[model samples]
Structure formats: structure tokens, C-alpha cells
Target: MKKQTKKGAAASRDERRMQQVFHALSAPPRRAILKYLAASSLTAGEISSRFDMAKPSVSQHLTILKTAGLVSRDKRGQYVHYALVKQTVETALMGLLTDLGAMPPAAEDKPLAEQDPSSPTAGRARKSGVATETDLPPAEKPAPAQMSMF
Candidate 1:
């Protein structure tokens, strides 16, 4: 049926996105970049200055992150500011866990925004009215080195 075909196509797209997210997170530099962006959005130069690697290397990592839907880039004048796309990362991880049977499947009857108010999806739906981390000034202090991924 046409409906089944559409569902299959969507599933294939999701699978590809999951693969991209896992691949982007596989690199140490990319992980570090995520940590930095977690604190605040930063320009490519700002991110590169924090690492010993050249700007092009950092840019390459950024490109991968962008392609993976892990990060978003906003061009402000001559500089491009990069910020973490938390929802995409969270969704990918949750989907992976669900696939691996590490977590139960989410309720599919209700749209995410209409589900639990405390859920990430609901939070994102309310983002326009909320003051998120990206709305704050860039943190001068680095992300705590001891922060755990889990």
C-alpha cells in the first residue's frame, strides 16, 4: 500500500539519521566540540582557539556535526555561530535505546508536544516562550571537565 511505502521511507530516513549521529559522536574531537557548545553557542574561531588543532580540522568536525543534525549554524554578519541541537541528539539516543530494548517505546498515540509536560519534546514546544541556555550570554567558564556523558 502507499501508506506502508511512505512509512518504510520514513523509517529508512530515521535509520540513516541514527547512523549519522552515532558516527559524529564516535570522534573525540567532535565530542569535545559538543561539550563546548553545550555551555554556549560559539563562533568557529572561538571553538578552534580552545583546541590545539587547526581551524580547518575544527571546521571539518563542525561540518560532520551539522550533517548529523547534532549542531546548527547561524550566520551572524561575518561569523558563523554554532549551537548544539539538543532535541535531535536526545531523540537519536532515545530511539537507539528503544531499538536495543534498553528502554520502552514511547507512547505513540499522542503527539510529543501533547505528552508529559516535563518531557523534552514538550519543553521544546514551549521554547519560544522560555529563556533557554542559548538565550544567555556565552559562558566564560568552560564546561566542567569531569562532566559525565551519561
Candidate 2:
């Protein structure tokens, strides 16, 4: 049926878009760039200065991000400024979470740790009586070695 064909076409387009977004997100540098842009827009030179990578490499990552609709570039006189397109990134992430049946809980709903006992935080909660806010475990110091003069 024509309806089925149209639906299939739309799905294919969506799949391609998802692939592009994920591919752009696959690299650590690219993710870091996104994090920087999330705070504020910056010129390409400013972005390159934040990392040790070559300018060309940063530019390539920016190109991929632009293609994925995660970022946009605007020309301010001679400089080109890059900024995060938050809506597009958020939509892709939210769609993926919905597909996985793990969309984050609404404020009115039970928190994720409480709702899913198998979650990592759930186990920690059981052991400690509540989930700890810190991401890292407490560090222990090494004992000092005793020194003796021969």
C-alpha cells in the first residue's frame, strides 16, 4: 500500500539521521566540543585552542557535528562561531531513551533508582541506606615506609 511505502520511507530517513548523530558523537574530542558549545558559542580558533589537536582535526569534527545537526556555525565578520543546537541533540537522545523503554522519570513519578531495583544506584542504596551523591569512592592513603640509616 502507498501508506506503508510512505511510512517505510520516513523510517529510513529517520534511521539515517540517527546514524549521522551517533557517528558524530562517537569520538571523545567531538563530545568534548559539544560540552564546550553547550556553555556558550565560541569562534573556531577559540575551540581549537581548548584542545591539543590540530586546527584541521578540530575543524573536521566541527564539520561532522554541523552535518549531524548538533551544531551550527555563524559568521561574525571574519570569524566563524560555533554553537550547540540543543534541541536536535536532546530530541535524538530522548528518542533513543524512549525506544529503550528507559526514558527518565518525570518529577511526579518515582525516581529511576527506586523504580528499578536492578539499577546500580539501587544496590548502593540498599548497602548504605541511601545513594551517595559523589561519583567516586573514598580514597585511602598509602602507609609511609619506615626509613633507617645504615
Candidate 3:
């Protein structure tokens, strides 16, 4: 349940919303388009002309961004105008990172046990030569069990 306060209810991440933002930003061309929009909204053709890539590819990128809700498309006469929906992009990334504890508080206090028991990361910690708080014991090969037939 979400809590309500004087400043209106706090916003929470919706996975679908994140999927939209991440999918849109996954392509380099789409990120470039967003940067361009941050400067000023541009028509589809205007953005298309800036890139050496074929216009259809650019259109496909634009379509993805539009689907993700990171970009809004408006039909202006015969042309389509695209603009960044900044809030959605910023919110999605920050929310994802925060939830994953990539940033502060929880990140700083994370328990070493959270790491996968079988991951090579343990070797990195030891090879770093810097003593780690993790201090995982070196893995030992278990004795092979002999099969007994009755």
C-alpha cells in the first residue's frame, strides 16, 4: 500500500514504466535523440536528417522512444514532432538504481552475504590483496561419493 501525505502520495516504480524507459534508452541512437530533444524539440524529419543512418532506422528508434513514454509524439500538419518526457526517464533510472542499492545508505551497509556463493567476484576480492570484509573461505573440492549397488 502507498502512503499519502501533505505533498500527495509518494511515487513508486512501476515495472512496466521502467521497461519502457530502459527499452527506449537501450539504443545509442535513441539516447542521442533524447539529448537533441533536451536542447529543443525537433520534427521527426529534422532529427532524421542529422544522422547519416537511413531515415527508416531513425524512425524505428523514434517509435521505440515513443512506445517507452520517454518521448512524446505529436502530429503537426504532415510532420511528427518529438520531445523528451524528462520526468519519466529520470524517475525510471533513479528508481531502478535506488531499489538496487547502487546509490548510498543501503549500498554502504550491504551485507557481504548478498553476493552469489559461487561467483568469481570472491576471487577478485582476495586477489585485490586488500583484505575484504567479505573474507570468504577458499573453496574446497568435496570428496567424491562412491555409488554403492545393493
Candidate 4:
């Protein structure tokens, strides 16, 4: 029981971390900025050229990205050059995906649901009151003749 409590606490901490990572990524402009940095570093002007948004609005997106540690900015001459922090971004996203039930899914040790074969399509299938993936029929391959008919 004590070990279970500790495990629960650890899981909660991990969930919170994953939430922060995903929350940072949920914004559209910030995602676009990351895409622009994928090829190479770009100046604020270069990034702005791709969108109709004002420079200051784009700058706000950059600030959000920096807060998430997804980008790094260097002042070169009169322009600030922004570059992708690829490793950090990838690590954070992958970590979040792993933490949110990807580590060990319901794939193992779960009892399968019982299904009624007489039920109509999209009918609920259950086994011991639980649904299993097999409740659905396998996908139908289109007939070659039918393909030609279309």
C-alpha cells in the first residue's frame, strides 16, 4: 500500500510535466514558428515575411516559444536570429506522449469483452461486460471488380 502511494505521486508529477509541455505546443502561431525554424535559423523579419500578421504579433509568438525552451535567439548585427532548439522540443513532446498512457497501454492482461454476433453493424460488443478490439469485424478489402466498376 505504501509503495502504491509512492507510485501514484510519481505518476501525478509526470502527468503535470507532460501537461506543461503540451500546453506550450497547443498554440498555432508558435507551432508555425517552429516549422519555420526547422530548415535553419531565421531572423524575425524572415519569419514575419511568411505571414500577414504584424511583426509585434509574431514577436509575441516567439516569446511564447522561448518560454517553452523550444527556440534560442542570438543578436547578430541589428537583427535577432532565432533558431530551433530541436532536441528540447522533440524530447518534451515525446516524453509527454510516453507519459500519457503510452508507456504501457491496456494491450496486456486485460480481459476481452463478449460480443453478440446477431447485433447490427456498429452494435456494441462486450465480453464479461468489457469491450474488446475484436468486437469489430476486420476491414473489408475492396473487390477488384468493384474497383473497376467505379
Ranking by TM-score: 1, 2, 3, 4
Alpha carbon deviation, residue 55, candidate 4 (Å): 0.9
**In order, what lDDT does every prediction score?**
0.81, 0.80, 0.73, 0.69
For each candidate in turn, the TM-score is 0.71, 0.65, 0.58, 0.55
Candidate with the larger lDDT of 2 and 4: 2
Ten residues in sequence with the least summed lDDT for candidate 3: 107-116
lDDT of 3 by residue, 1-150 (tens): 866674453233356667778888888888999999988889988999899999999999988888888889888899888999866765676567677878554432233333343655555653553325345455644545899897
Give candidate 4 misplaced runs (Cα > 4 Å): 1-20, 104-150
Superposed by TM-score, candidate 1 places the C-alpha of residue 14 at a distance from the truth, in angstroms, of 0.8
Better of 1 and 2 by TM-score: 1
lDDT of 1: 0.81
Give the alpha carbon lDDT tens digit for every residue of 36-118 in model 2: 99889999999999999899999999999999999999999999999998767766876777677777534113332354665
> How does residue 102 of candidate 3 score in lDDT?
81
Number of clashing residue pairs, candidate 1: 0
Q: CA shift at 62, candidate 2, in angstroms?
A: 0.2
Which 10-residue window of candidate 4 scores lowest in summed lDDT? Answer: 107-116
> Which has the better TM-score: candidate 1, or candidate 4?
1
Writing each residue's lDDT as its tens digit, candidate 1 over 1-150 gives 345588899988988998999999999999999999999999999999999998999999999999999999999999999999987876776677667887656633333343466644455655564334443335633465786789
Q: On TM-score, who's better, 1 or 3?
A: 1
| Higher-TM-score candidate of 3 and 4 | 3
